[model samples]
Target chain A: MAEIELPAGIMPDYRQQLPKFLKDYAGRWIGHAEVRPGVLKHWADDGQTCYTVRILLPPNGLLSAATVRRLAGWIRKYALTGRRTCRQSFELVGVAPDKIEELIAEVKASGLVVGGTGATWHQIKCCTSFVHCQNAAIDAPSIAKVLSDMLLALEEQKFPAPLKISVGGCPNQCGGGTDADIGITGVFRDPPQVDEEKLLAANEDIGLLISWCPTAAIRPKPLPEGMAVEINPARCVRCSSCAQVAPGGVSMGRERGAALSVGGQGGNSRGGPQMGAVIFPFLPAEPPDYALLKERVHSIIAYWLHEARPGEKIGSLAKRLGWGRFLAGVGVEDIESLIDDYYPARTVRRNLHFKF
Target chain B: MKAEWQELPLCRQLMQGLYPSHVAELSQTRYPLQMYEEGLKKGVSAYDYGGYISIPEIPSGAGVRTSRRPDILPESPYLRVLGPAGGWLSADTLERLADCAEKYGNGLIHLANGGTIELYAAREKLVPLVRELNSFGLDVGSTGDDLRCLTSCCGPARCDLALVDAPALATYLGQRFIDDQQYPGFPQKCKSAVAGCPNDCIRAMMQKDHSFIGVFRDLPVINNEEFKSWLAEGGDPERLVNGCPEKALKWDGHELFLDGDTCVRCMFCINNCPAIRPGRERGVAWVVGGKYGHRGPQGPMVGYVLVPFIPLTGEEGFVYLGDIFAAFLELWSEHGRRKERIGDFVARFGPRRILRALGLKAEPQILLWPKNNAFANKQGRRGGEGNGGN
Candidate 1:
């Protein structure tokens, strides 16, 4: 009579158990257990909350879900087994398209969301940086992690159009950072502003040091004034070219960061498929200093999202919009301060009817 | 109000959705389609040339979902069609699609990249409507990804830059291979586009999975006397020689001498020279994998030269290209992964791998021509010898 009958389809207070569930999963033999079913899942591996997912294959078949999730995930999971925070992807082998929705519901109920779809750049990929590659001129891994965090939100939201970004430590692109709407690479902004004391104290061997340059950009000298070696700076491609050959060859300018290039693609449109061009000389974006980089990327994305057609690539937009318009629109008044004119020696693209 | 897509009610949408099959399940449901039809019949067509639409502005969101309308019910009977280039046209097809909208249904034909005609119809009328359009040789369906219309260059009629006649090959091959104009299981969708001349006016460089373009080996020697007469009668020699990217031509006042080896045979000069001609021994050049979209380690690129196989004149040639493509499909579908276009598919196992997978030998002749950077001279040459090749 007191309406005690409707046993209250009350809110089942379940969120309170999240902490208990977390504690139980830790240090327990909850082996291969998935909280939610199919695709997305929240799991505890070695007592840490980890995100696991199932990727759907394209209509073209072959994929369990969509893309490099399994590929990128396998790289992170097996290759980076000890890391506390990890994202893992599993291929859903034999699932039908109609079942995707059903699996999505089960996964969402358990918590984690799927990765890389619609507008987001595929994944944050990095190659062995300066520590491993002979061709590496700078530290690419540090810059990659910085970029990954800087553009994390860009991964989930749908855009008026899709956008991509990449970062390369050296001229050889280890990180796809430079190919995106924005890119960053390591390079010196000026003649390595050296402390004369720092060079001499390092037992500078100028000859063997300079030999490390592929571009022969550095030249040593016996100067009367006290400047032992001066760099051409023009030929320097910002790879530890001179530093590896000569001791104290250069300090990464007075300030060190990464050089940025944009719109690298291999295509036969507007501009023939070619390497990305440098947009910023060097920005001091180590870890905490990503504010400027974030602002620069956000401004660019906001403009591009409004302007670009669905298939219009970033390179064409960068080219057609020119450095002047691009910089000006983004309110980057100090173009040189933002980027170095490494292209001064390059000539106008005179597409000779014939190539020699 | 060309086909009042928005006016069609939910019930009529379901009707049109069911109308295009052998079984007429929607025959009993006609009231809703009739209601939408009455509203669409009210618009007036005042313009003749420019339809309040251009290539880019044409409706792209059609057939985006099960219904022609995306936000509407998932099973709306609306249908949107795709065609070559989406807007790829021979001023004739452009005019015809435009006319169909003006006269019968709403003159709204949206073009698609893969090439084919897609029609939007009301549920009640879709049965009779499809049959009516079929009389004109138009088929309604999707034309992206797997199902596409075989594309061809406008060919010799408009361009002076083509090395061979692309239109003819496209017409011939299109007629032979793509009869049903429907999807069949293979490595993605098979794209066939022909470039009449080597200049590839039809974008064969970045289209068709299997592209056949023209190439010339020998230099086109000028009939000096005839060339001089044309020059005297106002032909530009600089335009003719400069047309060649190789700068393979030297006009020695009396004659035009072509540097035979430098003749990448881009037809710039041949197209420009009134007295010049295509060499008699000329033939078609075959290429594969010319898609230009997205990138990984290897991104989208223009077609690579497969083999400068001898020109095929009739049905035999179509069979040659088809068989070669079939071999490629067998290898790629079996080996390639998702998001891999043909080039990436080939690059994955290696170009040699692709060739071996297709049981093909690496023909040196295939490497004879560089596929990209196929250029053309923008000179306005009226009429001349393009067929004369040696």
Candidate 2:
């Protein structure tokens, strides 16, 4: 075998770059306690303590160049080490307890919020809505902004447990919304539309489009001129696979809205991590205010606050009380769509276990 | 320099009120927001999603993937640069990263959900960009059918609840498997993550194929002094005592007592009550086959805990774990079908058979007891038994 020259870069050693205090207490942290909503105090074995201040970012982890430069300055000034969290937030590590107030002020002055820790609403992770992606059924970023604006105060409020929310433009779910406590995914009630002219002009492989449908909804039809594809409305799940395959040939239909799913979490602590189950299969995604989506989320959180045990995640509570009773508690009517009959083999109920 | 751009009325409306908006930030990027505006006008993606132009001449191991945007941009293949495993970056490095983003490719640097930073650049400029990134102490990888970036939470460096040094472990495994990260030789894309503890702040157990989770076997330790102080600071004892999922906590007036047998170490008590801390004995749990994609037969799945506990001894603690991981990857690449995700493969091919193939003994942790029916009563068997008849 010949020696291959790999990419010349090695990851910068964080130990050499991190703040002095963090380097000193690299693997010696004993325990931590939340000082306030966004402040955390960690103790080392030598009794030295350091505080961490968390700053929140908007959906999709977007940051302007100016904002990035300012954040870089903050990282250089307030605390030497900064980290981008998995949930689209930033943390200023190794802050002295006394300087936390100053850092928070600096962050706020720069049009940023400083709370995503403790039992409150975390950042709303949304995928690129109509801004960049062609698969967007609903204006996800606008709706997410509405939700974030309404729930901004709750970022400090102590709920029964922390709530994670995600929004997807289409069912492809580029945002991984199904893994969140409250997942809002764009759905198409109708099937896709096939353009005969575009289909013929693109010269797409008709067989490929016919086979790529997850539900086999797309089928070939012989027109007078050539071959085209037709979609079966009942059979179609509107997954956008055909649209992605032949961009000019096929596309999703106009009838679109958002679906609300509840009780999903990624943590192994409470219920060992499960995908959220759909409660409301369709809700009108009116941008700028998204009143329906906001109302549904508020209702679910209210029910959680009223019923859930102190540290019990909404998913764990739903699992304990059963989805039927949990949805009823949120004033939701049990409907056929909630049962998820899409995959009949995997979801059939066999036993007599009922929580209703 | 900012490019010519026009923010839509909807984008402007969304950008109004509260914290900064993703729309505003996106508009500032040099990714041709005008094309997006055109997309909104036409109700379809301005950029084509068709398969990338095949470039067979370039080496397969190069850190590049084809990306094409019809009518607006030329053939610009993107690069997937590995992010810092520990999620730490110096301020100077961040500035240089922005500079790099502006200098090469589109001005936008996409922080992908998989923890890789993506930038769009033409094929001709990829080698120079990789060299520049290398000089800045960053590398390009985590694309195609190979090992993805090993992401980890900020462990003992800043977090107090961390039981293991997550960043260290991630760095160790990442360096050992650097070849895997750079090469496109796997049956399909493989992702891995290391969570410092079971809190799973990084969400590896639900999303990654290979997840190394920090675990402890003993009950949480309670400090009476801290408990009294916490109560004095208005921490509700009733909430803390009743919130335990396992009901393992008991408050006998002055001190807190725990039921050792009943406690499952779910971190509920330790999370709510700062007075309580995790146990002494700590190690990493090797969980495999978790994924978030809706593709494949099994759909999304939570990884099965293959080995309940693997002790961390010293600086070279991950060597043994790396050996096990490498062997599993080799086994998977040989047997797995093309484009088949690991979770689906594991579900189709039983976990017991996988364990047997790897020459490992299954513990109770590896079993999915009762086999999807709540009424069945059966004991979970180790590997070698026919999945304990229910």
TM-score of candidate 2 on Cα atoms, chains taken together: 0.87
Worst 10 residues of 2 chain A by lDDT: A7-16
Per-residue error for B226 in candidate 1, Å, reads 2.6
lDDT of every predicted structure (CA atoms): 0.43, 0.74
Q: Score the docking of each candidate (DockQ).
A: 0.01, 0.45
Residue lDDT tens for model 2, A62-158 = 6655566777888777776778888777787777677888889888887788887877888777776665455678766666778888787454378
Query: If chain B of candidate 2 is superposed on the true chain B, what is its TM-score?
Result: 0.88
What are the runs in model 2 whose C-alpha is more than 4 Å off? A1-13, A129-139, A153-156, A192-236, A239-254, A286-289, A302-312, A317-322, A329-331, A343-356, B1-7, B40-43, B50-77, B121-125, B370-390
Q: Residue by residue across A1-356, what tens digits does model 1's lDDT show?
A: 46554211111111111223322442222112223332222223354433333432111111111122323333232221111000111223122334556555543443323343334443333332321122333444333444444445454355533344555444334343433456665444455444456676666666645554445666666655444666677766555434433434354443445666566543222333345555666565533235666566667677766665544556656556665676566556655554323334352445544322
TM score of chain A per candidate: 0.54, 0.91
Best by TM-score: 2
Q: Over the stretch B247-335, how does candidate 2's per-residue lDDT look in tens digits?
A: 78898878888999988888878877778888888888999888765555555567888899888745578888888899889878877
Steric overlap count per candidate: 48, 0
